[model samples]
Structure formats: structure tokens, C-alpha cells
Target: LPRRGADTPSLAAKRGKIARFYLAHASRANNWDLVDLSAPYIIGRWLLYPDADGKLPDRGILDTLASHSDLWHQRIGIVATLALIRQGQTADTLRIATRLLDHRHDLIHKATGWMLREVGKKDPGCLLEYLESHFRDMPRTALRYAIERLPEPQRLYWLKRQ
Candidate 1:
């Protein structure tokens, strides 16, 4: 929610300005807390909803972030999916999560797994279906985070798949 009921372009402009600043300084603000705090509410939310002009959200920005060599940028991209998850919009999260499944960093793994867990909260079948297909290749930390909410038996089943 940028401005609740109002489609004020000034706020939109401000948001854009903030995004630009972040894009430039993401490396300096490489701390996990900083990325987690802002990317979701600002970047991710912008990707899911129309602004004042009623323009459709552009997902290409996410693709850019995901494909970047910077770890924080990639984390920002995956964690930004939190906005979609909150709105019962898990598709983007799922799509982005898949792209980072084989990532080498634990931060990406935890973020991906956390997003997957959130997706399970909204749609268990969706998460289960994904895990069923990719659990073996998934990192142990990620698999643990992703299956944290499942039943004991189901959790065991997924973990054993490793």
C-alpha cells in the first residue's frame, strides 16, 4: 500500500527515487537486515501492484536483480517476493525461487526456503509439489526452512529425500 486509496504520483515518484538510490547503493547496504527491511515493502510491492498511472508492474527489474553477480542484489530479488506472498500472490515467489534453487550462498538458500515456507502458508500443495520435484538437490538449510511447517511425517519424508 503506497498510499492506501490515493494514487498520488508524488509518492510514486518518491518510491521510484528510493528504488534508484537503493539500486546504486545496494552494495554498501549489503547487510542482510537492510535488504530484508526495504526490498519487500518497496521493490517487491511495486512489482505486484499498479502505481498512480495505472501502469502494469514490470517484472524485468526482478530478473535483472536475480541475474546480478552481487549477492545482496540477488537476495533482494528473492526476498522481495515477500510482497507477493503477503497478497496471496505466490507465483512470482515460486518463479524467482526456482531461479535461485542452486545458488551457492546460505543467505539465498534461507531466503528461498523462507519464501517457499511462506508460499506453503498460502498454498501447501504448491510448496509440496515444488519440494517433491527438487528436494534432493536443495540445500540442507533451505530444505529445513521450507519444511518447517509441515507435519512430522511429511517433514521427515522431505528431509529423508536428501
Candidate 2:
């Protein structure tokens, strides 16, 4: 059974172990059905321990879970990363968000925008700077999200560019 507390070291270790176990299983598990079981475990563990110190995951570690190319896993990863940013881990999130924007996947594009929107909520000027630089290149959905919280007039102005 999954543990209920986030603060316990033992529980944290257990979650990490579960996540690693599922990740290993995902590598060998051919059925997409089995892959689903690992998805939540991996995402849950990442949510539990976002790398707030800005250390990228080791290459070996990333290789182990490379199967996360699955759309569902990418979506969950994006949501978890955004949740971290919303919780005020802006510096760390900025690193993650920047990398996500380079992803070719459309879902990741939207997720990057979602995180940028939260950053905008904390500092609208910063968002505007990013928008001014990237709006023309960003996916429409992403651009809209990054601008969604702006004042009515500002929102209309950006929307007009669409």
C-alpha cells in the first residue's frame, strides 16, 4: 500500500523504491497496460521530490526511464513540474520550464506555457518580457496560457496578434 505522509524519511525512501521498481518494470514491460501502473508511481515520486537545487538528473537515471516518451508520462511530468513552480520554487522551475519549451511535443509546449503563466502571476513584467521575445514562435495554446492572467486590455492586445 502507498504511504500517506510526505514528511517521513522512511516513507520517502519507500516511495523512491517504488518508483524505481516501476521504472525498471516499465523497461521490460511490453504491454502498454503494464506501463500505466508505473506512470503514477514515477510521477508521484517526482512530485514528492522536485530537484529544487537545480541539479539535473544523472544521464543514467534519465536513460532508465527514457520510455517516459509516452504522452501520459510527459503530461504528468509537466503537471508535477508546474505544481512545483506554483508552490514558489521559481528558480528551479525556471530551469525545468526552459528545457520543456524545447520539447517537440505539443503537450509539452502547452505545459511549458502553463508553468510560465504561474511565473507571470508572480511577476508579470518577467512574463511580458518572455512573451515579447517568444510569442511569435510559441504554440498558440502556450502563448494564450502565458497571457491569460493579464488585464483585459493587455489580453485583447495579445489575442489580436493571434
Candidate 3:
């Protein structure tokens, strides 16, 4: 169970401990809102910080979550990358999206496509490039979500693509 109070820990050690606790308990993290609220702070922030070797955290964390037996964990994997996306980092999102391409869950599809739509918001060209290359195989719900903000003509072009 996560701490649900308004009391903010002022010590670095406490915050670190809390973050670690979140990571350890992620498998038990059920529900979309729970994941959406917690993942960015724990997994996302952890990945943003480089380690002793000056090497960035392994984004394979997302991949691990993507492969979890739990569907909630899978959502955590993708949603956690939201922190990275906020910092203008997108590769992990794209990589995770590719891995979840065949995911059967509507929640997974929505989450993946939401991230891609976010990518489009940041760099439409990049989204266009991705869509051009992979839209054919993208699930319709995901495709619709990803292109929700695109201009009508371009959106139509992609939709009608053979």
C-alpha cells in the first residue's frame, strides 16, 4: 500500500526509500489511475537520473514491464515513460509502442496510442514518419487515438491507405 497522506517527506533518504518502495510494489499496483499516478514519479524519475558510471538507467525496465504476466504491470511500463516524454525523450516510448503492437487489451492499445499521439503533439513529422512506416499494422483504435489531432486530409490519407 502506498502512503496516501498530504505529509511530504522533506529528507532525501525518505524520498529515496519511498521511490524504492514503489518500484518493489509495482506488481501489486492495480488499476489505470494507480499506475498513471505512481509510475512517472518512481520509474520515470529513476530512469531520468544517470548512475555512478554516468550511464543512464536501462530503459529495459519498460520492456520488462511490457512482458509481465500482469496487464496492469504492462500499462505501468508504458505509462511510466510519461516522465521521459515530458523531458522530451521519445525513443523509449517508441520502443515500448513497438513491443506492445500485438497487445490485445484495449487499455494497452489506448495507452500505446496515447503515447504516440503525444509524440505527434511534440513532433508531428516524427509521428508522420512512424505512421507512414507502421500504421498499416497498428490497431484501429490505436490509430484513431494517435491521429485524433491531425488535420482531416492527412488523417483521411492514413485511414484510407491500402
Candidate 4:
């Protein structure tokens, strides 16, 4: 189980250690929920947290995990972005969605599509732009999921593109 707060003075350092420990034991995070809950709190937060200098951390970790062979880890890469998404950050979700577009697993397709739909919820224009480029090639499951919340006419447009 992850502790909420460790030591305030060394919060960042301790969180980094905790994130590393959880990631090192990622194999134990076998299911989608586990990965979803843990990634944002640990891995995602660790990588995205700003330091005292106000410099944000790099997001390469998500890209690496997104391309990992293990299904659970791959799911974690996308699902973790939910944290950023809720905070109105959509760029990471879009980038990760692009990388996972060709993945064959239904679970990966679902996760990617879910995130894309969420991005749409926050920024409809962004989702429209993404679908314009990739809707034709998107897996049926993903495409359907991505357009699930669109108005009927708009949803029909993307469905027709398939």
C-alpha cells in the first residue's frame, strides 16, 4: 500500500524512492486497476512533479512503458495519464495514444481509446483533430470507444470514415 505523505521536508525524495520501489515491483501490479491507481500516484506523479526550481520532470518514462512488451505495463503507461488528464493536461494522452495505436491487444486498444475519449471530453477540438488523422486506421474497438460520447452526427462521421 502507498502512504499518502511521508516527510514534508523530504517529500520529493521519499516519493521518488517509493515510486522506484513500486516500479521495480511492477510485475506485482498485475491488473488494470492496480496499475491505474498506483501509476498516477507513484510513477506518473514522480515523473511529472516539479522540483524547487520549478523545473518539471521529463515524461520519457511513460513512452518507454507504453512500448513495453508486458500488457500490464503498457496499460499502466496510458492509464497513468488519467491523472494529467483530470488536471486538464491532454498532450501526454495524445502522445501516448499515438504510440499505442498499433498495439494488437484489445485491452491496450480499450485503454488507449478510453484516454482519447477523455481527452475529447476536455477538448473536443483536439479529439477531432486526432480522429481526422487516425480514425481510418484506428482499431474498430478503439474508434468506437473514442467516439462514444460524441453527438450523433459527429459520431456518425467518424464511424463512416471506418
Candidate 5:
């Protein structure tokens, strides 16, 4: 079980240690249920470790973290990556988003779509291109999320394909 410590000067260090412990334990779990239960702690830790300027973990570190054995951890890692992208880390975000779209997990599919939606806000054409190219392969939930915020005509155009 994860510890809930009272706030203190070393709170960050404690949280970091807890996160690492959870991540290590979660990585060894053979059951998906256990992994699912541990994901929140791992994600909470990564979010808390944002850089001084509020940037997310470095791309290399994030990528390595994404390699954990648990699918739930991968999902949370992808969501963290999406959050980073939303915070202006476009290059790394896009790279991870692309890889996540290919993942077998439905949650990963949705997370990738959600990230693409954010990217769409800044570059609709890129999202449109990605949608057109991948729509046939994308899960419906993912496709819907990717196109949800587009203008009515565009949304209808994509939704009609389902």
C-alpha cells in the first residue's frame, strides 16, 4: 500500500521515493488488477516532479518509464505525456502519441486521441491528416475523441464514417 505522509520540508523527496517504490512494485505485478491499482500513485508522482519551469519529465525519461511491463502504467505514462503536450511539449508529445495510437490498450487509444485533440487545437490540419490516415484503424472511441472539438461540419464528416 502507498503511504500518505503529512506535508513537510522533504515532502518532494518522500513523494519521489514513494513513486519509485510503487513503480517498482507495479512493474513486477503479474496481475493487471494490481497494476491498475498502482497506476494512480505512479502518475501522481510523475506529475509532481514537473521541472522548475513546469515542464514534464524529459522525453527520454518518459520514454523509458513508458516501457514498464504493466499496461496500466503505460496508459498513465501516455496520459502524462499528453499532459506535457498540452503544456507545450509538442515534439515529444507527438512522438509518444503516435506510438500510443498503435498500442493494443483501448485506454491508450483514447489517450492518444485526446492528445491529438489538443494538438488539433493548435494545428487542425495535422489532426485532420492523422485522422484521415488512421481512421480506419483507430478505435471508434478514439476517433470520436480526436474529432470531438472540431467545427460541426468537420465533426459530422468524421462521425459519419462510423
Candidate 6:
């Protein structure tokens, strides 16, 4: 239900309002497809850039979504980091991945691993270190996804460590 192209002069302000509205009604984003389609473009884009006043946006919302009890919200939180990963900003993605690493839901595990795989694409060292530190404890689905692009020996090593 998010609208596009505000006539208002302040582009940031227009997008800000729309992003806020999206969060207010985020519960309606009932399905994974709805979330994957929208969170990156709206929440991710909104937080990635500075505001109209030019201050860095607070990223606490990412933590909030990651820690929330709602499954879809948690999925949104991890998936939203896709935008940041695309821009080579993997810090937020890693942080959220850590938060959701032990999540019980298969979907959250998939999202976290998918985002980490993206981080690997952008920065392989970061992803390797993260795997080295947590491979033993991380979920198999996530481990498989994160190491999908690594060389065969490295992938086998991480998988064997589990």
C-alpha cells in the first residue's frame, strides 16, 4: 500500500512519511513474498540514507525487528539488510545476522544466511571470520547458505566442523 512520488519538495520528507506509514501497518505484511518485495525498498532504503536534515538515520529499528516476537517482523528485520549489503555496508547485516542466528524459524534462518551470503559476495573476509567464529553453533541451513560461494575445501571444512 506504499505510495510513490510525493509532490512535496523535500524528497526525504516524503519518503520518510511513507516509510513510517509502512512500519505502522507492517503487521499487514502477512506473507514472506510481501515482506521480501517491500522491506528492502522501503525500510532498508529509508534507513540506509541520511534524512532531509542530513543526519544519519538511527538503525535501532533493525534490532527491534530482529528481536521482536513476531515471525514476520523478524523476517523483515533480517531481510531489510539486503539493501545495505547491496551497497557494501555489511555491518548492519552482520549485526542482525548475529541477532537472528539462533532463531527457531526456518524462514529467519534462510533470510539471515541469505544476507550473509550476500555479505560474502561483497566482502569475503568478513563472512569467513563470522563463519569461523560461529559455524559450530549456527544452524545448518544458515551455514550452508553462507558458505555456498566458498571454495569446495573451505565449504567442506565449515560443514565438517558442525
Per-prediction CA RMSD (Å):
1.6, 6.0, 5.0, 3.1, 5.9, 3.3
The TM-score ranking, best first, is 6, 1, 4, 3, 5, 2
* Tens-digit lDDT track of model 2 for 1-162: 234554444545655666556555544544334433444345434554524343323323422233266654444444444434554555544555554555677666676677678888877777788777667767777777778888989988887876
Task: Tell how far residue 24 is off in model 3, in angstroms.
Answer: 1.7
lDDT per prediction? 0.84, 0.57, 0.81, 0.82, 0.63, 0.86
TM-score of every prediction relative to native? 0.91, 0.58, 0.83, 0.87, 0.60, 0.91
TM-score of 5: 0.60
**Residue 121 lDDT in candidate 6:** 96
Candidate 1 regions with alpha-carbon error over 4 angstroms: 1-3
Q: Please say which candidate is ahead in TM-score: 1 or 4.
A: 1
| Tens-digit lDDT string for candidate 5 (17-81) | 66666657654644445544554345434554543344544446556656665676675555555
Residue pairs with clashing backbones, model 2: none
Cα miss at 43, model 2 (Å)?
4.0
Summarize candidate 1's per-residue lDDT along 14-85 as a digit string, tens digits.
666677677788787587899999899878767765655767568878878888999999999888989889
Q: How far does residue 70 in candidate 2 sit from its true spot (Å)? A: 3.2
lDDT for position 41 in model 5: 47
The digit string of per-residue lDDT tens for model 6 on 1-162 reads 124653333767777887889889889998889999999999998886666777656889999988888899898898998988898898899889998878898888888888999999999999999998888778999999999999999999988899
TM-score of 3: 0.83
Q: How many residue pairs clash in each candidate?
A: 0, 0, 0, 0, 0, 0
> Which of the two, 3 or 6, has more lDDT?
6
Candidate closest to the true structure, highest lDDT: 6
Give candidate 6's whole-model lDDT.
0.86
> Which ten contiguous residues of candidate 4 have the minimum total lDDT?
1-10
* Residue 73, model 6: Cα distance from true site in angstroms: 0.7
Model 1 vs. true fold: TM: 0.91
Ranking by lDDT: 6, 1, 4, 3, 5, 2
